[model samples]
Target: MIGILAAAALQADAPVEWTALQQDNIQVAELAYDVGIALAVICRDDQLMVAITGLPDPAPGAKFRKLEVNIPGAELQASTWRIQGKATISLAPAVYARRLRTADHLTVRAPAEEGEPARRYELALPSDHLALDQTLEACDVPLVLETDLTYDPTISAVTWATSPRITPPNRLPPGGYAEVVLECTVGARGRPENCRAIREQPANSGFARSALLSIRTGRLGLIDGGPPPVGGVFRTRLTINVVN
Candidate 1:
């Protein structure tokens, strides 16, 4: 992790300017740049974040209040905040890793108010896969492995606020059993977000939906000690076994 932190620090100091837009286009948005580590490593807490500096504050009641980001294999939305004269978007670590690994370009669209036109900006990705790999490894970051996640007692102890109710779908035959797996990020506050099904035994079963709902609404207990949970990957497995 120290190596990753160092690399990220270097990147932060001299980020590559990826793209810039005219003031008229984005209401003072200047440029989108890349710091070597796609996800910003918060050295103080070892949390992962993605920040895009240089955007104007949004108007009240804007249609696209959140920023829309798209890469080759993923489409993500992030909430923005005005800090130090720039608009910034924070991305989940898991999401950032998934998209940045193979993405060649990043496209971002800003939300517009009732009468304002939406602005779009695109950024080219750096072509250093080896460095990126090392960076990810140094951070001990896991690849987006949906079905292969092992249970982490520390994460589970704090995150498992309530037991998820897994109901066997009516579509299943007698004595049927299925396994559902989900991948999610637990923030510093221990709240889960970006929950999605990594694997479901039976296609079209409601198990995945139920699991997602439970994760989102469940309360997370506070975690103490090393690194804030921000962007920490959490996976849960639910096996529904029907009785005769």
Candidate 2:
């Protein structure tokens, strides 16, 4: 069964924190910031790659389809991996080590699907250069970049909804309970969409189904005049301890 997780606002100026996670044999160093934007550097199979999320689909027949980074006195372009809503660019480890050390911002300019003028998306470097340098070293990349300003996200408010009703399975033990975890993407309109269960205790338990149904029917509300929703992500946990 699916469940609703708590909703939290993502800050725009949030301090950049690099986190490393392993997927299969690949090592991914990622930083999420500025309203759904995720920047990641991946190392796998003797190759290095960079990816950025929150980009719109590219227009057909577009001639210039690549990512651009602004460094001191130079602009660099590389072949881009175009997906539905995000883009990635492959980089040699040596090249990445040099560019990431000096680049101030990464930008993407792509034509809108509806033929509108190209839009430019840019993300600034985090102020904590030392930490970023450390992260780069951990990834086996050299650190040559430095910055002095520190920034953190300006969070508005976090709101919660009433717990959903859970129907216990008939065959459960007298005091046994099940738990489910859900990940949801909250839309700009403050509605929970694209919710899915990520983990569940007790395989094949019916609690997951009940949790999803309740979330689909439940409403999540945000505070008035709060920072406009940034299409951020949130998680919720649901537990069913009572029997029908």
Candidate 3:
């Protein structure tokens, strides 16, 4: 019984032979060999993740070892590295949650060393351009964000029209001036329809009315999807010219 127990202890402390991994965008910084091998990685915390290239054997299943990552250029302060699955076994690649936006951004805050201010840097992560659960065939798959946008419209022509009416002032002093507001409906077709004076001036309102009639009438453009403009109001200032 004593011999059997001693042999079991040695078996438990044996190291499993493995090959060095060549993952794109990831570099293996250090490796420690003990009862089991431990790997240290230097990679971007945002978007950069890890994955197991080779699978375990068909029989019992390959065991997941523990993995560690060191963020260089950071002050050695009291900090803890968080790992998913809460398992000490070899660390797996960092899993990212699905985000429905233009791009993903992460800001890491590390204690500033002696002179450098508390260092804070932003990292832009690759977006999941493909749909969820999309299988990737390539060993090195590049994740990209898909953006669908519409183009802007170009103006073919533009024209402005003015009214031909005089506005009356409230307290028409010797030669005071005032402006009246004219309400017109400009449709998407670019035609000025229902042209009329919604507001009135004091006595010389006729002059203001004539000024509004000077505007030209025409179709602006094809209104296939655009809604026609309704109840549009425009302000026009008219000088009061009373006949002598």
Candidate 4:
């Protein structure tokens, strides 16, 4: 029927473009390949996770704790808790992101033991990747006090009374993602002020503005234990990857 055909043409899912969401300052995006596999990039609370799911099961009696991964220009190892059907693997987010952003395909070899041959599978990497770019660009950093002491300047330092909640900027492209870095000065009570968006991948994408506004509404100060950090905290570099 023409009606059915028209409805199918407007399907919400697409292979080339990824879907994304934001919650509690966490960014998440996922894309699916035609070959029964899906990849997800989860950015949360200062950690990044890449999950590859819906993998073919290993042969019975085989065992593995890691997967051998091959993508354009690189060969590496991936850790996974599930080694059987629908296995999920975790690799270095930075390394995987670098490849995912540009590579056309990824090959994975399952570990085989006791003279068994390794099973191999290939995954197609989608190209329209804006959803992922924005997720990585989004940030949730806790501001701390600046000081100078021989040993413990932050004898009783503090941080945000409540953590900031951030979202993707309105100016991001439909399927284009971005990266942004910010350096914020702490004002009274550890409120972030004068935040300088030190970096933005696409230049004026609005990612920086969203992060700064959210930070201004919150406060930052010390670790929960009130103990000085082993190494003084001033700056940190957080890089990320995506699914868009």
Which one is best on lDDT? 4
lDDT for 119 (candidate 2) = 60
Q: Candidate 2 residues 1-244, lDDT tens each? A: 0000001113465456665656575665656666546666666654555655555555554322444444222453423333322343432334443454466665555444566665676666554444345445556664543321110011112344533456565566445888777767776456557878776667677767767776665445642213325576656666777645
Q: What are the per-residue Cα lDDT tens digits for candidate 1 across 37-81?
A: 222322112344345543445654332235666632345443332
Off by more than 4 A, model 3: 1-178, 217-244
- On the 0 to 100 scale, the lDDT of residue 244 in model 1 is 69
- Model 4, 1-244: lDDT tens digits are 1222223224444464567867786686676655555666667776766666655454564333456675324554443333323445453454455456667777777677446667667767778777776655553321111211111111122344676765667756445566556565556665656666666656677766776676667656443224323433332112223355
Q: Rate the local accuracy (lDDT) of all candidates.
A: 0.48, 0.51, 0.31, 0.53
Better of 2 and 3 by lDDT: 2
Q: Which stretches of candidate 1 lie over 4 Å from their true place?
A: 1-44, 59-65, 72-87, 129-135, 143-244
